[model samples]
Target chain A: MSHLTREALARLVDEMPDERERTHLESCAGCRAELAALTDQRQALATLPDLEPGPDAWPALRAQLRREGLVRERRLPGVAAARAAAAMVLFLAGGAAGYLARGPADPPPSLETPSRVAGGAAPVDPAVAAAAQGATTDVEASASEAFMVALDRYMAATDAPPADPAARLAALENIVLTTAEALHEAPTDPIISSYHLSALAQRNAVLRQLSGDGGPPVF
Target chain B: MTDDELVRRAKTGEEAALHALYRRYAPRVHAVVRRLAGDDALAEDWAQEAWLRAFRALPRFRGEAAFSTWLHRVAVNSALQGLRSRARHEVRETVLPDDQAGPPESPATLRLTLERAVASLPEGMRQVLVLHDVEGFTHEEIGEMLGIAAGTSKSQLFKARAKMRESLGSREMATEGKAYVASDA
Candidate 1:
């Protein structure tokens, strides 16, 4: 008795087979089972879902095709996104290749660019310098000083463990006091004045955040 | 216009006639395209493209086949290219776009459940099966579309049916196969 392979049994099921294959299907129980399975399969296939995509499917298609336009022209809108995508691909590829090509043994120091325009002190104004060696406007000097002090304190805090809630509140109090003094001293300069106001707002918000309940100012 | 007249006007660059022809056979063409491409969107694109091809090369058409037959041939050719590309791409790509993720039903109503199962077949098998079973193309006509011998189409069809049967065996599988084709009829 010849055993029917799955393929052979499958072929035999759909087709009007020659006398031999038909006879084989009937006589071989194994083939018979295979045949029944195939028959059941055909029946099941007949029950498959209707796959007629309707008109609503067109837009997604148009968009995908436009996206895939690797060649098709007249750029289909979203130019910025396209540029961004291409740029991102370029950046990743360049970065990955660079990292891979270079040895991991020596890592370069991270680079940070401080913006001079944003409020870093320019060369000091001579008249202000005559009055106070560090004075541009007292606000500018103080904001700059405040910024540096904040930086130093933050750096120190990182080295030492951060102070507890009470100590943190005390530190915030000093920031507001210094900001208020700078504001009063440098009333002429808007930049220092804005920074001073922001500092006060920040201290106030922190006070609120620290105090779970509403009450008078502490310290 | 009658199909013959439409083909004639379509051949003469009568866009209206061609569009009319498309409107007339769009459903059937859409069905064939969807079934062949296995991606509804791609199939629709192929269908529109097929009509455009037919429209563009209308002059070259020499009445070698019936208008619908010729259009179907163009459609099948356009569809097969898309299918081949998708097959090639699926091999290269790890992720599939959601629309291309699987088959969806076309606008046309489906008959037997087996049709969708049959639809999930490889393009070669699906083409032969649709040509033979649904559209009533003889093994010979299918052979022409596929450029294979008549006997080859029949065997592929046989193979297609069996493969479909095998895929249907697992009860755990639910809507595991996908197929969509539009219809004009």
Candidate 2:
């Protein structure tokens, strides 16, 4: 008789063969060896190790969950108190600066004037500084410290309000370039893609604002 | 904490509990999703979506099954749904590269070769093969998931095994030829 067909051998990997095929297997060395190989293959496949997804899986998923409101930030008990304390410090310092900058008779500068009033003595660009601070709080809480630091720099570069629009435009251009580079590492990341789009929109707005055109706000 | 406690907290929207569950199950979830997708590029998204669905469905979980079992079923279903959607939208094919030229010298190498072989199988055969042999789902269970008959699942499995054998043979990863013993019988 002939050796069993490959189909027969494959089936025999899991199912028992009929009497004729069993007799054939008893005598046929070739078919038995092939059957053993098939069995081994099955065992190998079943034992394959579980794989972890990309290293950034949690951060990406966390960002998505946060976006969908499926999960909320879980902060330790003291975090809210710390944030409140920081806010109070800022308030007191603002009061001190307003008192020092204007005569005591003058009403505190309108909220609009704070940016300009503080501009002269500001250690950092106020808008950039605030966004850099918020980048940690507003962005993914699970993101690595290095990523947050890098994003802080990116936000500062993209948000700085230097007197020269061209310089600001250059900064926006840098944001676009760097965000694009980040996207190469994580092409489907919503957060990074949003940053890229924001930078592009900001670049267009800056160009339009320079040409005295009305469009997306300069900020 | 027990999965029950974690599930309770996660249902209440406690992010730390959710994180803990993810840490516990992500590797297993990713493995199943990756095999189902047969593509690394799509696996991550599908795994993430599986977790999203699980989180969304936690409140309705009646605790009829183990948390890992429920999560596994969720991942399988999520990946199957994703594959079906992709099939409706596009006709994509996975072209496996030429097999490596030498006999695999290590168990790790053989495992890698087997993984590639499975990933490269035709969609139907690969799915049935993975769900049945690899994931240890019975044909009845696979039939329910794939909307096919159990007999059809078996037929596809046999075909998948034969094809997988040929794949391994081509890679020289199959058993030593003709070292004859019915003892293996």
Candidate 3:
């Protein structure tokens, strides 16, 4: 009876003691008293009252849960919207930085003509052309690349101006527009000189074409 | 509506079904949580949170157990989880003025002292107490619910009851009974 332990007392309180255990407990006066204590404990815990909720808590929790969205699900629109706004600002900032770096006046054009060789005009590097196209983030760099392309295309065209003044004028117009674009990108750049020169030459070619020069001379 | 139909409608985001389920089980959940924490406000918060959790998890309902049983499980679980969080209103630093709720010696104390005591018990013991005694889960059911041996469940129950006696008995839980120390033979 004195040997009956707490586990045994606990088992009896929960009513799970085996027949042998029960027989031992029956003979033990101490075990029976302990069992009564545990029974009383269980009874007290059973009677605790219900906790009613307050009014202000529901709306806050509902909005938070829905907006948080569980990890397994897609994020709520509120979060996504904020991220999108942030991305737009960064992209515009890049463009603004490029504009600021190029500053106020068009730079003068470079005199670095294609080094003439024996066989034919040197081939413009394709990599240089690609670099020019992607230079939108750096206004000066993009403008320089555009100038190179326009120069290369003009050099490759036949020297003689067409008899139709309109055809000649159109070519001059393209040069003028390309020059304006370059100047806008690097207002104070030296390269603007070459662009201005190209525009002047094309204007001369247009006057020749209109004067019944009888189509551009072959080659 | 039946649990199945309500669950299906809730899956489609029917506000009515969610409110219905809340009305049906909130009292029982509130009652169980109140017993576990002893704080009316915390119990209510957890009860509502349990419903919110149920709404979120409703899409996964495979109908394996009765809906009410699952809800009670979530409610108890939510209370236990709140208890485990440690940061959720740790024992108040300031004492409230004693009015009608009485002193710690009285069960009607304005500040519920039971929450801290229940939160103080070890996870295993406190959890079992919440399940069997207050939540009314049978030993067999708790065994199946928690995946422990039935004998293990009974032992845990006894140990938890003994611990609760110590925790609550400090003042508020003290009752007219001989103190019995739970021992493992």
Two-way DockQ contest, 1 vs 3, winner: 3
lDDT of 2 by residue, B33-130 (tens): 99888887788899999999998899899899999999999999999999998887764555445463344545556666777888878889999999
Query: How many residue pairs clash (N, CA or C atoms closer than 3 angstroms) in each of the candidate models, in the order given?
Result: 23, 0, 17
**CAPRI class of candidate 2:** acceptable
Model 2 misplacement above 4 A? A75-219, B93-104, B174-185
Fnat of candidate 1, please?
Answer: 0.15
Q: Which candidate wins on TM-score?
A: 2
lDDT of 3 at A175: 50
Q: What's the TM-score of chain A alone for every prediction?
A: 0.28, 0.36, 0.27
Minimum summed lDDT over a 10-residue window in model 1 chain A is located at A108-117
lDDT of each: 0.52, 0.68, 0.53
Candidate 2 chain B worst ten-residue window by lDDT = B176-185
TM-score of structure candidate 2:
0.61
Q: Which candidate's lDDT is highest?
A: 2
DockQ-based CAPRI category assigned to the predicted complex of candidate 3? incorrect
Q: Estimate each model's TM-score.
A: 0.43, 0.61, 0.44
Model 2 lDDT tens row, A124-170? 43422332343333332322222333334434543443354665566
> Which regions of candidate 1 fall more than 4 Å away from where they truly are?
A1-6, A13-20, A27-219, B11-16, B91-115, B135-155, B170-185
TM-score, chain B only, every model?
0.67, 0.86, 0.59
Residues A1-219 of candidate 3: C-alpha lDDT, one tens digit per residue? 346565556557766778777787778765666566667666655665655455554555456555655222212123222222122222222222222223324331222322221112433333223322322333333233333454443433223232334434544555555545444544554445444554556456546656766554311
